[model samples]
Target: MNTEVIWTFLSTQGADFALKVLGALAAWVVGRWLIGIVVALIGRALEAGKRVDATLIQYLKSIISVLLTLVLVLAILDIFGVHTTSFAALFAGAGLAIGAAWSGMLGNFAAGVFLQVLRPYKVGDFISAAGVTGTVKELGLFATTIVTPDNVLTVVGNNKVIADTIQNYSAEPYRRVDCVAKVANSVDAQDAIARLRPAIAAIPNVRTTPAPDIEILQFTPEGPLLCVRPYTHTDHYWQVYFDTHKAIVATFGAAGYPVPETPVAHRMVAAG
Candidate 1:
């Protein structure tokens, strides 16, 4: 085009376009800051109520953040003269395509909603779900965060979690710590049980109401496998478990019990 035409276009449309670009950037920054504040306020309000579960609180916070962010994007688009009605139609079409692509994410989101309603497990609960055994860190809209025993942070889809069997260890007041002790075949089983009863009970955090159960579980080639089960709170399960083993060793060693050995068979061919 001619220089005069180019100069006019740059002076009018170019400046307006630059202004719109700057406005969009400013809106995005301010909108994000406002969204964060709103999400945080809602979270604080929910926590102050003291009635909502923490897991549910986190899920709600995530949902609110996403929705508010979407609103912010629409507002910024409006600044660029993109009509909200047009954007809505575009969004609806995009939603259909995105939903088809991220069907699993939508499934996880639905499962998370159901999980909040059903109240199967909550934050800080140790549970085994979807083959993951760990303490629940957070329940997000799309996934559940778990910190495993080995201290690994894992994120599993909520759909997988809800579809699988969940064992909530923290659901009950107490749980059994399973341990086994092998006694020599010649050792009197009754005496071993008698010695273990008090020793296992002496361990810290072991529940006294049900008492510890020490009994012959089964016989193996080595000896009679004594099941040493101690009941304790889930928080102290590992402590009691390890201490029970130590107690068994200390009691048996002090009593001079023979070590159980697997009898190996030897064949002789007469030197043929």
Candidate 2:
């Protein structure tokens, strides 16, 4: 009689355990499908809004999915008679510890959010930040990736970018190309202006509305300094800058005009 009772008890316990296992499996499958549906709905809402950055939307969707999956996991654990309240409290404590330990990562994430909202610069914008200059390639939750003009790829922490000044070269419609030329005192100012002005004005991307400004700026120890200021649309700033110098060198060489030995410092800015 005792043996029969033991067998019956064992069968009941086994069946209960099997039911729990099946329930957990069902919850996992259904929960995962629901999470997918939720994520898709969120994506649709963000797409319709059109106010959020593309990269930020992707990051937010991933976070939402992770959070939902975590909740689903906890529910499944509860089916196994696990202590969920204590587990959640323990999870919160552990999260706090991790957050304190990885505070820099948290800061980067915050900065990334701020950057996305502020719209200081966007992907494909050439910018200088965090002591580096490059074209923005991607914006992530923790880091921003940029590709240098020379093709060097740099990954910078978003926190670092927030701490520095951001110079956006591509934000404006026009950029100024500042060229200084130290010509020999013997060169006639009018002649030099006449020669350089038209050459700069004739460049393909140089803006003609304001026209190119060429005049004698100041005299230094080297010789007479002529400022060759030209306005060009932002995209052609660099090319026009280098090409103008090349043309200057060629023009002076052909005219037998002397250039001073002193190096000229170039200062560029948004065109005035």
Candidate 3:
């Protein structure tokens, strides 16, 4: 090739390459800035809508921003003469492989989606599932986080939670606490219940409207077993249970009522 021809070709190609690079860079920068602005606007709008949870709104906005940014990046690459079709195909293949490898996780993800949509439980609510009772700390894409009464953090798989029966204690504003007290067979069950009524009602957090009830459950060899059922505010269940128990014991003791003791039965074999 002649020197003049080579120089002319190099000059033309170099300018074109520089312009393309600049255009790609500019597109990326602009796209990133636009995504940021949109995300910020979404967050503000969600905050203004007090009906929705702010944390959930923020997470949704973040996801949208990420997806939009990815699309913009691919578009910029395509504009710079990069073949994106093969890249997209590769991405799809990888996604399929991952899905196959983690089928259980995909199921959990689906369950999580259902849970979010149905709004069965929210953060800070008390729920019982899979024999574990705790306050919900977070709801994630694949698991639900809970903090137990002992301050232990538990992570429950979304799929397992969905598949199992769930008991939401915080769903209602009030709850009833049921307690069983065993009195001596000699003690009058009805009198024992009457004595407990005043004290149970006086306990803090115990509801007055429903009125507590005491029933003689069964007659054991030791004494009469009684059941005490009291209605209380949901938040005061534990407090009422413990307080009522102590009050019942003290009241029975002060009344001079004899508490039945468990008697041991001894079988005597006659000498043969």
Candidate 4:
């Protein structure tokens, strides 16, 4: 209301509070920058070793970031005149409550640790876990990041991933690419198999050691369904899959094979 009162307020309470706020802001900015640098340095150091697992490096980065961020928060609280000791005591006292409230998160964290030790799947590996099939992008403190075949980024809880079955396509040196081909009922099954065997083997990246498998899987009303499976590295699965289908089409078309169509039966009911 008056200049003297305003000056008194500004000199005492207002100035101290404003200074604390600014100091807290400055600490937050600097702390975050330092945390980023530390995490980056750690990542580079681990990667430079060439023996360290990329998944483990990512997990370590996540943990270090969390711990540093927590420290930064405490420092900011101290800047505002909150005693760090008292705050830490309060946190310790509330540990049980926090654990109970965040049980799922804690479970995920524990699962992540087990995953690191067990090494079921690693970053860049294509795997199917917890119903998510994709290439593992990163294994974090509480979640596994997967980039799906369709380019979707999916995050799955580590707990769920560990609890469920995991199928790692890249674990083996080569994986089978399953493709099917249908020939007309009149077409010779053996001849179709003969044509496909060499054509599929000619595809780039297809393994010759095991050889491509071309066999009649089953019989449908249209024709005999041939299972055309090619073995290749998981990295070339899609290429071999698409090429197998194209080979079947070109080979059949060049051989003048008729298209297999589902035969529809027509019955006439007698009038009552």
Best by TM-score: 2
Candidate 4 minimal-lDDT segment of 10 residues: 263-272
Q: In candidate 1, list every pair of residues with a backbone clash.
A: none
> Judged by lDDT against the true structure, how good is candidate 2?
0.85
Each prediction's whole-model lDDT (CA) = 0.90, 0.85, 0.84, 0.91
Q: For residues 8-69, could you state the per-residue lDDT of candidate 4 as single tens digits?
A: 88888997889899999999999999999999999998789665567778978998999899
Q: Name model 2 segments beyond 4 Å from true.
A: 1-42, 53-55, 65-85, 261-272
Clashes (N, CA, C under 3 Å) per candidate: 0, 0, 2, 0
For model 4, the superposed segments whose C-alpha errors exceed 4 Å read 1-93, 264-272
Q: Give the better candidate number (1 or 2) by lDDT.
A: 1
Give the RMSD in angstroms, all C-alphas superposed, for model 4. 9.7
TM-score of 1: 0.67
TM-score of each: 0.67, 0.71, 0.70, 0.66
Instruction: Residues 1-272, candidate 3: write the lDDT tens digits.
Output: 69988788778787887788899999989999999999998878767855445556766797899889878988988877999999889889998999999999989978886787677898888899877799999988789999998999999999999999999989987788988888876777888888888978888888887888778888787788888888987678889999989988888889998867666551122222
Locate the minimum summed-lDDT window of 10 residues in model 2.
263-272
The order of the candidates by lDDT, greatest first, is 4, 1, 2, 3
What is the Cα-based TM-score of model 2? Answer: 0.71
